[model samples]
Target: MKKQRANDSGWRGSPEVWFQAAIEILLESGVDAVKISTLAKRLNISRTSFYWFFADREELLSALVDAWKDKNTGSIITQSEAYADSLAEATLNVFDCWLDDTLFDSRFEFAIRSWSLQSREIQSEVKQADAIRLESLSRMFSRFGFSDLQADVHARTIYLVQIGYISMQTKESLADRMIRIPDYVKTFTGEYPKQNELERFYYRHGYKNNASS
Candidate 1:
């Protein structure tokens, strides 16, 4: 990951690289190591190259959180429509996405959670994002005929668990996470876990098997 430090000039690459680098360094090292210069160096670009996409550090942070929302919340909410077979399937799909999506990976969630300690803007964004996510869960539960207030309480609990679980470093497989998440969802709504293998939620995508990074 060693590279030349980017100076604010060219579009070295997509803003995604900077966001990804910021999360990686933030998790592996800490917020102190997530500066624009650090990201540029990580990407083998110039520090100033950051400005080609983001105006300042705060903007980069905001963009990171926003991208996180798109992956963890927006995509899940949209795909929730296709999850008509069962509520357990839908909820697990969202929870599994938390682990599988690069935007909500352990690196980024750990970073944003740490960065939120000082940045009120990021705190607000995080709160807003969580609320939206809970709402999506609530709506999904209601679609399965769960009561409104019950859905709200259950959704909040499930959402918190999903986020908390992200920070857990386990030797479990993506399939294990996919298999286990349904227990949390069932706990939240008092719904029963899938009794048959056919009804269990299974992830259909590949998690980047990042062995070296």
Candidate 2:
């Protein structure tokens, strides 16, 4: 825990402010680094101020897990349920999450997964999130007329690949990833996205001219 001035004379940070600071520490140095004293120094507030927003460290940690569930898992469920005219379009809608940080926080996801390795509770939460996300994806596929078994398999394929990317922290240039998007979509959905659909996806990601189609 790095030391800094605890300028908590009159300023008390809100829950969101405290949570964001904790998230920064968690992402930068893992969960163990997210201490009240450290956060106070980081936020320039008193260590006691943390209690104004949370009962204790465990409460704050619980909030972090809840936020992870709401953001990452919730994003997947939302995207899976988003309307699309075709399976390819539906798959692309889900893929939008990978390209858009506002929709999916990959670094946060990676950090939570890493934290799960040390805590059985977090590990269970991760497993539950995975099952829920997979079920949502399966439903997405089922909506396109796939049988339950086929939908489950395809959903797993799509999800496991993305999880592999996050777990491995795979890096690829935007152009490189863009070049592969169509094929990946095809592989996931068994249908290549049409040129117009690709354009829409690219535009949504602010890469309108990057569409291979």
Candidate 3:
């Protein structure tokens, strides 16, 4: 945590630096708490420095929305685009988002959705993001030989389940989620994952086998 005053120090003053602080505040408190004064104090910088990066607080909020779009929605689309030998494999790629925060942060998602409650603008952005994400999941299913209707339904099922999980603030341990993952993949894709497919996913994520645990 590099905390320093603007006049007496070496703050990079990067937009991302400010954006990060704002996001932290947004998650911890509500969007209203993401004020320039609060962020300046959090970053240990002068309030004037914030204007250098954002014209206004709304600009900063928009930046947060863009960040959520890029990280959460973009990542899922990228995973959906990646090569998968089977439907289950493709489903697991999406599953990686749920398991890994770096890929799709549930906290950010929840925070943004919460913010949406107060602003139609944010709500519209969230809806658009949902459409993009669902489309990506639908395409992933289509590539795996599912018909259009089937792909659409499966995509909605996969996406809504995760959204519902976040909205409900469901709590489950990593080990518990890992134990349920294979069954989840199978149910979504309608085929049991082969051992190798399961192994690849588990090894990539460093999940210990439940049986061995």
Over 4 Å off, model 3:
1-12, 210-213
Q: For each candidate in turn, give its C-alpha RMSD to the true structure in angstroms.
A: 6.9, 4.3, 3.6
Candidate closer to the true structure by TM-score (higher is better), 1 or 3 = 3
User: Measured by TM-score, how close is model 1 to the native structure?
Assistant: 0.72
Greater TM-score among 1 and 2 belongs to: 2
lDDT (tens digit, per residue) of candidate 3 on 1-213: 223456633454767788888889988998989998898888888898777667888777878888999999999999999888888888888888888899999999999999999999999999999999999999888887789999999999999999999999999987888888888887887888888888889888888785743
Which window of 10 residues has the lowest lDDT sum in candidate 2? Answer: 1-10
Pick by lDDT: 1 or 2, better one? 2
lDDT of 2 by residue, 81-155 (tens): 999999999999899889898888999999999999999999999999999999999999999999999999999
Q: How far is candidate 2 from the true structure (C-alpha RMSD, Å)?
A: 4.3
Q: Report the C-alpha lDDT of model 1 over 45-69, residue by residue, as the tens digit.
A: 8787777677789777666677667
Better of 2 and 3 by lDDT: 2
Candidate 1 Cα errors over 4 Å, as ranges: 1-20, 167-182, 193-200, 203-213
lDDT of 1: 0.66
Candidate 1 local Cα displacement, residue 13, angstroms: 5.2
Poorest stretch of ten by lDDT in candidate 3: 1-10
Off-target runs (Cα >4 Å) in candidate 2 are: 1-10, 210-213
Q: After superposition, how far is residue 74 of candidate 2 from its true place, in Å?
A: 0.6
